[model samples]
Target: MALLRDMTLGQYIPGESFVHRLDPRTKIIVTMLLIILLFLVETFQGYGLIALFIGGLILLARLSPRFVLRGIRPMLVIILFTLVLHVFLSEGEIIGQLGPLKVTKEGLFKGGMMVTRLLLLIIGASLLTLTTSPIALTDGIEAILSPGKRFGLPAHELAMMMTIALRFIPTLLEEMDKITKAQMARGADFETGNIVQRAKSLLPLLVPLFVSAFRRADELAVAMEARCYRGGEGRTKMKQLLFTGRDYAVISLTLTFAVIVGSLF
Candidate 1:
């Protein structure tokens, strides 16, 4: 349950900070640019620059560093697995040994760099959901995809689907946690077995979770129908999206930073 609560990727925190006030489109674009930069950079110095940039954004947003970083807890297993695989499997000068496995200097460097990249990517993406509301995120994504409407794209539907998936992440996690606890109270053992056994133990939990998710979906659909909800055709937004001067300035600065970082170390 604690682990589920620590998951913040799909959660939003309301605030009046500069980052929270930026146009959703601006935040979305900057996040994409940062993710692109993360993949493009190789050197530690470049990663350091990106880290600083993200840290600055966190400060500007006035978000708790602990709260922001808690989002990484659920992904720790994947991160560690990547590090272990790289260390044991990558060929290079052997730096150490564990039983039959050899650890190489190159492997260590590569693993550390990969882990750093993953962390930065996670944090950068989390910031988007942390600061932007679901409605605004949907609006921004739809607007970005609107250009494709000429090619028969269902922009609004696509955006809504993406947003809903993200929005439901925490809800589903909480539901799973609750079901796990309930099953455990009824003498179900989920943590006392090997990988295969533990997975099998989850069968009971998954059954209830799926039923709950389907029920919620049905309820939401009925509620939407009750409200006379339709697709985006001829629909209008109550709060129109407008890019202010601050948005332009931020976008320009982000692009300039990306170019400079790409050209430099």
Candidate 2:
């Protein structure tokens, strides 16, 4: 699978790496801050620093260097489209010409900036999911959003839903793959139809997928009910997350980096 080869996002790899050891809440907070900084930055210098930040994280996480490259490679179309949009629409001094279009010096720089921001954001966000388990991620989200409960927000439910959706991605993909193979074995042509016909053919595939999803959901609900499951009102975590000296050390370093970058550019 392309995903198995490239995007490790949302797939937890077990290790004793420092990144794997940090509190999930710390990783979540750090990732959030990095994403905010990505959007707020505009200068090339700023992007350079961000690049270094994310690059360091990839190294620190002990993820494959191939992974960082692969993460960006599949998204090349999106980055190129973003660059092209900026090139045609941005107004500036005409530096050169591309066919019937004009290329502005500012547009090129802006395109570079846009592409860098998007790449970093994707890689950073993916790293969080890669290093943290779905359960840990859900707990972190609930903990961070717990204050919203006073405003009647369903923080715990939302967290559970999000984590479940992520956890289901690989499961659903495998299911679809199996279905496609079986259909092919039966001479169900999914590839020989015209665009519209192909679209129609997909109906057979989707019907089974939806049915499987619902069946699994029902099984999960019944299992939870059987175990006397309730809402988050007074639920106690079997493995309660706690911040240690390492967590504070990581947070302190993140704050320091944020301040330094903000001041520099």
Candidate 3:
């Protein structure tokens, strides 16, 4: 339950910081570039540089470091599994032994690097949502995709769907948490068995969750219809988005830093 509440992926924290003030389009493009840079990064030094960059962003955003990182808690199991898999399966110079399994230096390095990459990726993405509002994010996405409208692309519709999906993530998680607690109160056991048993235990949870999700979707559709919410065909935004000098400077600096880090390390 605490884990669900800790998730900050789709939740926005209102602030008057530099990051929060940037044009959403600039932030979106920078985030995409950072993601691409992550894939190109192959050295610890490069990762370190990227980490510093992200840390600077966090500072500029005036966000709590602990809050920004709390989202990683839910992913710890998967990250640990990845590390263990790499350590035991990858063949290299043996460093130690755990029973019949051998630990290798190369494996340790690869696993650590992979874990760092994942952490940075998550933090970068989280920062984007934390600083930008849902409406702004939708506008940024729609604007970026608008050029494709010539090819019959429904840019506005796609952007709206994406934003709504992100917005619902936390809502769904909270719903799941409530359902779990309710089931536990009724003597349901979700944590007492082997992997297979535990999975089977979730059957009851999934059924109700799905039903709830569908119900919410139906309700949302009805609400939108009631409000006469049409697609972007004749839509005009209440708040216009325009890039400023700060946005251009941030974008330029980010690109330059990414290029240098990619080339140097």
Candidate 4:
């Protein structure tokens, strides 16, 4: 469950700096462009450039690398498990041989590459959310999806739901954490048990969490209706976002990076 919390999909740290000030739409576009560029990075030189670029963004965001790495700590076990599995299962000319296991240079090379890619992808995206707010990210998502509304898509409504959901993730996680602590206080033991017993202990934790989540949803629905919240029609933003020169510069630099990385292929 802690690993689930560490997924980093919707985790947003609050900030008011320049990166935080950019329109959500601009940030989403720029982030996606950078991620796409990452796939184009193959050679060590390309990876080095990508590292430098992301490092610069980290500095600009004023976020500690330690915090970013902390978000990835829970996944370290899975990463190592994967690397080990790939190294042993992959067939190649034997680099070393034990009693029943064989190791190959090719296997180690491929597994290492896979793990590195996973680390970079997670850390890179985490950097985006670490510097941006959930509201801003949702707003950006809605802005980017607005054009789809013309094709009979409920883009605004979808975005609104997503925004609200993202806004609640941390709150819900905190709630779950508290609930788990309460259950533990009542003699619910998650550790020191077999797999089945450990899983069963989760039941007590989950039941109250689900019931409370439902109650919250019902209350939110009632509140939304009380506010006469209709769909996207006749809605106006109190603080409409406008992109500036810096936004364009960021986008242009992202595009140039893409081109340079693409040339490496």
Candidate 5:
């Protein structure tokens, strides 16, 4: 469940561009809208439209495609695996058969659709994270959950936990990488071992990581209490959130697009 704490989005880089200035809530909402529309899209033409729309977003955010691709590089292997499985194993009207395996037009179409859907999901969500700051994202979450706090929902506490978790993801990843290397240098043999042996090799790395994470949590809790930190109650924001004309324009466009895509399917 480390991902429960880890931020999947890219490290937020603050800029004075049009994207950075939009209200966090608006950004979050638009991102959700985009993802929903992405799944709603059925035809290949619809997917193309979504791709162009996302490209426009990346352009608006002023981020390089190289950097965005870097964020998704780690996921490519899994995506490829999925694509391969879908392409080879799926059953359809026989286009060819060899050694108990069949390749067909339906299989090809299904596999291509799966791969395309996955790519759209990953890239679209990555765009959201690439453009939004952690603090702003947390604030957006808290604002969305504000109403639930009236029923003792612990909205602020959850947000605080998420904030700490997001903040430490990179640090923990570096630590894990270092720990892995250190174990390797000690003849841990993680790579060459059988599945069970490889799994066993991870214990040396994981125990210390868990211990360190627990210690950090304890220290952070103490530090928060020492500073008289409380929940979101009665706390005023340093920056007031406001929706701009650009936000309205983006939302209207997304909603319209979503309706069109739904109708197309």
Candidate 6:
């Protein structure tokens, strides 16, 4: 599927822009705050403001608009499904009807709101990963979770697990693509069928993909053990994270973004 290649999770784009230069921790925290703001955005005005905010950030990061938005393509089905569910299931003044289901104004409003929220969250996270390397993201997460160590939480381990999972998304997708192509080359029919037939055809694809994933996991575990890896106890970082004036500038910018959306929007 061409869609697999468009999935940009956990990948980084190298750049010399201000966004790429900001500390990973700063990006993580600011992105978290923006998500909180996204939830509170209820009005079309709010949506417009957020659109501008995300658009500006995308441009600032020197990212291609098409590339960044490409990740959303695969999610269209789920988005439409949610919209339809809301249209049929939610109650209010019925503005239209599709067979037995009634589409209400409130449902339309909510469906649009739900779409906006998902889009904002998706785009925001994509922007973060697009600008920050996976290693830097791991470091940022560990730093954020370090405070939980006082409560006996395995912060470093948790961060490492999260990082590994995020990092594997693209890798595993690529592996599946390769496997699919290989199978197709051998005359395995995947595209010439009805819905059920096509689904059955994918059974051959999934088995190899899962086997490859488990094998990779086993190899990773063995490699870690060979290096004498244990839990995150007594771990030391090579590069100590420090907040600088630029990081504070990020804070100011986030605050400005909030005010712009909340007040003017």
Winning model by TM-score: 2
lDDT of 2 by residue, 116-135 (tens): 88988888888898789888
Candidate 6: C-alpha lDDT: 0.86
Better of 4 and 6 by lDDT: 6
Candidate 4: where is the Cα deviation over 4 Å?
Answer: 1-11, 170-187
Assess candidate 5 and give its TM-score to the true structure.
Answer: 0.86
Question: Which residue segments of model 6 deviate by more than 4 Å?
Answer: 162-219, 259-265
lDDT of 1 by residue, 1-265 (tens): 5765677986889999999999999999999999999989999999999999999999999999999999998999999999999889999999899999999999999999999999999999999999999889889989988999999999988987886787788799888889989999999998797999999998999999999999998998898779877887878889899999999999999999999998886
Q: Which candidate do you rate higher for TM-score, 2 or 3?
A: 2
Per-model TM-score versus the true fold: 0.85, 0.90, 0.83, 0.87, 0.86, 0.81
Q: Residue 149 lDDT in model 5?
A: 83
| Best candidate (score: lDDT) | 1
Candidate 4 global CA lDDT score = 0.79
- Pitting candidate 2 against candidate 6, the one with the higher lDDT is 6
RMSD versus native structure for model 4? 2.6
Give the TM-score (vs. native) of candidate 4: 0.87
Error of 6 at 237 (Å): 2.4
Compare candidates 1 and 3 on lDDT and give the better one: 1
Candidates 5 and 6, the one with greater TM-score: 5
lDDT score at residue 66, model 4, on the 0-100 scale: 82
| CA lDDT for candidate 5 | 0.79
For all candidates in order, the CA lDDT equals 0.92, 0.84, 0.91, 0.79, 0.79, 0.86
Order of the predicted models by lDDT, top scorer first:
1, 3, 6, 2, 4, 5
Task: Record all residue pairs in model 6 with backbone atoms less than 3 Å apart, i.e. clashing.
Answer: none
Worst 10 residues of 1 by lDDT: 1-10
